[model samples]
Target chain A: MASLKNIVGGELKGYTELLQDARQEALNRMIDQAKQLGANAVVNVRFSTSSVAQGAAELYVYGTAVRLG
Target chain B: MFDSISIVIFGVLFIVGYLAGTINEKRHYKSIKKREEKLLSLPAISMKRLESSDGITKSELVSESVVVSIDYFKRALAILKVLIGGSVGPYESLIDRARREAVLRMKESAPGAAIIINVRVETSTIGNAANSKGAVGSVEALAYGTAVWK
Candidate 1:
């Protein structure tokens, strides 16, 4: 989340399951990204999202990936 | 005859929905108000550094999240917003509710922690369409931080 947005807008989905699946998928992808970057740990993890169309939403996750000795 | 019956059914649903949605929104707002009064006393901040180092012992990651659906009235209001291409008022409140709910949840996650630092909030939209005509406008908010004790 860059800034706390006061506006409330959401996606209209056909199946509720798809919505959750998207979130989970985003999380997995981010973690994998961190791992691939040779990060041993991720700190201060956060997520933000927005929709590109009527039925689709984009979930974004970010954090400080670090290596611990 | 069928048309009349369908009209009556929809009319009843509209009335019930209106009452339920308004009541729920008002109640949630009240709850947010009460919780905020307490959370404000704590030193919640965006920085990773702690304000005080006295008796500091615990550090852990804590998080809280909530999902809220847009009521029919809000959806209708948002539709009008879409037409005008301006700020969406109903969504503002929904997002507010989600954020505050996440904050309260963070407090509960670690009631004993003195302060939460490096806090962040993330939001997403998740609405389930009940029908072709009905728009399910739902949003989810997630807040997370490193909790510390002194």
Candidate 2:
């Protein structure tokens, strides 16, 4: 048996109305990457956001892809 | 001479900021309370399992994010707090409201779901730096969870 580890990220900026879009994009991207690695589910998810510049911020979400039964 | 003038100017500005900030904070808190009452049942709980997954018809993710600006008075107080090594009370309430509002918005997004599980809120301060007077800081709160629709 073997275990693997990797990290991925996404970014977006706009009105508060569209903020969720960015968050989902980041999360979905992480899920997609995990699925590519053939993981069952993601665990220990951690979400982070930071300012890229004035009036704009970027959301970064990550998690450990795992196989659970 | 120049220092005294600058001091007076800042003092007056501080007074104005304090007055406006107090009023704004009060109004915001009032609104938060009202909405919180409406959302009392839709808790953004951290528990991974909200209810029995047995009868769950479907599952999906729900997320909400909000950004709020810190008033000048709070910013000034935060500066003083940095120097005195104390907590910035105003910023704390701002963060509190942001998180609640984010959760409330999440509930709105998942209208079919009654409760969300594994909920978490993340915050970020949008500014030039953690401690900077050059720009007004804005706090962004993001809340997400797994919603089971039955």
Candidate 3:
């Protein structure tokens, strides 16, 4: 079975294309992690972020962590 | 005789100090309340225009508004007035009111339209200690979201 994948821009982008670059990078990381799991697809994915450090930004990518049928 | 004299003096001094402290607290409470009220009355808005997904035809306007930025300084001092607890701290209530008011405004502003996802709440502070301690502090709240009508 083949896996499905999806990604949406993070809120920090705020109508600007520049920050989208960072979001894309985060998404790429998620895609690579999924591929490493030998999964054909990612589904029900979601994104969240927080200021892990006083002046730093942390982006999180979470999904079902599923296996394809 | 000497012991009684010392006791009387100590009692008088303690009473005076207590009275002074109470007066200061009252003044502080008044100032804080005025600041909170000013912030609550301020108007804030978030606006969005929805057109055809392909960027054609007219646009629809949606707005959300509320009093915003109520922090340690802007929240009512009534709670502190009790020297412990009171019926104040409307931070959550303020947010709820703003959301409701904005939805109502949107309903009136644009009828027969479904607002899109991505509703946003933004807060900003105004009059951040503009002058003296007696000055009133203010804040503004805005709501942002998309509107889609077919």
Candidate 4:
């Protein structure tokens, strides 16, 4: 797969899919936490991605949970 | 002398990359335009708060990220650009597409939102080629905002 990417030199669809999945997972987890706190909404959202290993990355997401009256 | 077979291989790769890359970019841009038109009514603003929060009963955080890769042909152009020390045109479009796509996805995730406030977009390079020489790298764009609706 790596060799093919070097030759084709186009969008890495597989890697993109992987990252998207990871991001969605992180977002869902954040939402679940907010739900546990009885929050109807979350604001001031933020996200950051960092390479935790040679070939792995970590997607971190956070926001302020709030209940709208 | 450099091997002729390798030169031919390189040429083939370059042509293939160029053809495939152009098609991919055109299709992506077309989809982006259509989606942008469809979502035009939803306003996304960078301001921290709105003048009035009247009737805003719910709010939620929405975010999206996308990773776009460069084709061999464009990477070659960028490498030559490095020597001449000027802006890399190919990379500019790549980042543009990534940002727009990310924002679009963020908006899509909040279908019921009235408006998205405090929107932010950020970008970075990732993958094996990010810090190395002669390999292609991918650009990641993250867009986030708070979606509020009545």
Candidate 5:
């Protein structure tokens, strides 16, 4: 499986599954962006988050955009 | 009189150097964190959870271990244009070098494998906190790669 990291970091509360859901949400957005850009894979992925802002805040996701088979 | 003047000058230079080094260290730390944050926010090309053993996995069956190390310095540069302070170079290199060594070991152990999926790189602090400036932080890089015969 190819790995990736989102470009932002923030406080995530609740359980692991919830965090995973949020991560998936961000991943889906990233995949959509990649698909639009005609890229198949992303590598050297990293993740980051900002300090906790609010109960609901923004999550930034990014990765090394790549084309894969 | 001349000796006194030289001592004063040396002291001033020392203080200046220390201050400059501290400022640079802070900048480097911020930059590293920023880059990490940016990398983490993006959607992943793919995500999977692997087991030491169990149900079959997705993608192809390529048993390989790939170790990747990210220098907080390089990461800092990528995130922010900050030249890390002096002492950090060696530690960062150490972490990277260790990762490289581990990767090579993986290669040696697992031959005939093009890549190592479910790759995980672990990092730990090497020295005492007093010795390392705040720039010294431990990191572990994990990734899954496909080992295709090339």
Candidate 6:
């Protein structure tokens, strides 16, 4: 991958988009779970990412579900 | 022995990487400053909770993540720094940009919210080169918080 074109490094746009999409999907799932619990808000949200396999990564998101009056 | 042609090619690539990386970083910083000013009204705080939760009508989770790649020039600088045993200055701006961009996007996602609390920012390196040597890699920054509106 050290070709001449790769010499001048820049933003990996495709990888960026892919990670963003994966994160969004994880967040959406968390939100859905919170909704199922009849919670209107989630606080103290946190995100974690790990490379589970070569060329594969996992995004884990969690938070506290709460009802704001 | 190192071929003269290969050395010349390497030198050219280093120059190109430096020029392009500098320009890209400058443009990104400019954009970041502009957006930060535009979103100045909404504050994202790291406090887990507000002093008074009163009058908070609604709240929801908001987050944004970004992956930024490093240029060959900066990577070379980082390698050099590793040998010298000092701070890697070239990568600082890269991380800063990624973090700021993530936070900005998080704020953008919750436009109507009055404030964001319990904000958290996490970073990690991702890409084929992340674990390998002699290759460029990307950093991922994730920002999250709870946006509340009164």
> In order of the candidates, what TM-score does chain B achieve?
0.84, 0.84, 0.41, 0.93, 0.32, 0.91
Which RMSD does model 5 reach against the true structure?
15.7
Instruction: Give one digit per residue, the lDDT tens place, for model 2 in B1-150.
Output: 999999997787667667766776678678778888987776667997754567788777777787666655667777788788877786688788788778888888887776788988888875555347555356678888887677
Candidate 2, residue A50: how far the Cα is off, in Å: 4.2
* lDDT tens per residue, model 5, B1-150: 999997886566445534543454455456555654544422222224433434333333221122222332333333332354444553454354434443444334444543355454433321222133332222322222343332
Better of 1 and 2 by DockQ: 2
Order the candidates by lDDT, highest first — what do you get?
A: 4, 6, 2, 1, 3, 5
TM-scores, chain A, per candidate: 0.67, 0.71, 0.61, 0.91, 0.61, 0.87
As for candidate 2, its clashing pairs are: none
Q: List ranges where model 2 is wrong by over 4 Å.
A: A1-21, A31-45, A50-58, A64-69, B1-12
lDDT of 6 by residue, B21-85 (tens): 88888998999999999999999999888889899998887877777877767777887887898
TM-score of 3: 0.32
Tell me the tens digit of each residue's lDDT in model 3 across A1-69. 000000010111121132235545776898889899988676545545443543234545566556778
Error of 3 at B141 (Å): 2.0
User: Candidate 1 docking: what grade?
Assistant: incorrect
lDDT of each: 0.68, 0.70, 0.41, 0.81, 0.39, 0.81
Question: What lDDT tens digits, residue by residue, belong to model 6 across residues A4-38?
Answer: 32455555667778888998898899999999999
Model 1 agreement with the true structure over B1-150: per-residue lDDT tens digits: 999998887576556556766777788888889888977766567897865677889887776677677666566666677888988877788789888887788877887788899888877665343222544456677777889977
Backbone clashes (count) for model 6? 0
Query: Candidate 2 residues A1-69, lDDT tens each?
Result: 000000000011244556667777988899999999999898768788878887577888888899878
Off by over 4 Å in 4: A1-11, A24-43, A63-69, B130-136
Question: How do the residues B58-113 of candidate 3 rate in per-residue lDDT, one tens digit apiece?
Answer: 33324433332222222323225445756444334434443444444434455445
Better of 2 and 6 by lDDT: 6
**Error of model 1, residue B72, in angstroms:** 1.3
Which 10 successive residues of model 2 chain A have the least lDDT summed?
A1-10
Candidate 1 local lDDT, A1-69, one digit each (tens): 100011122322223345447756877787799899999788767767677667566777777889889
Name the lDDT of candidate 1: 0.68
> Model 4, A1-69: lDDT tens per residue?
643654444456677778879988988999999999999887677888887765677888888999999
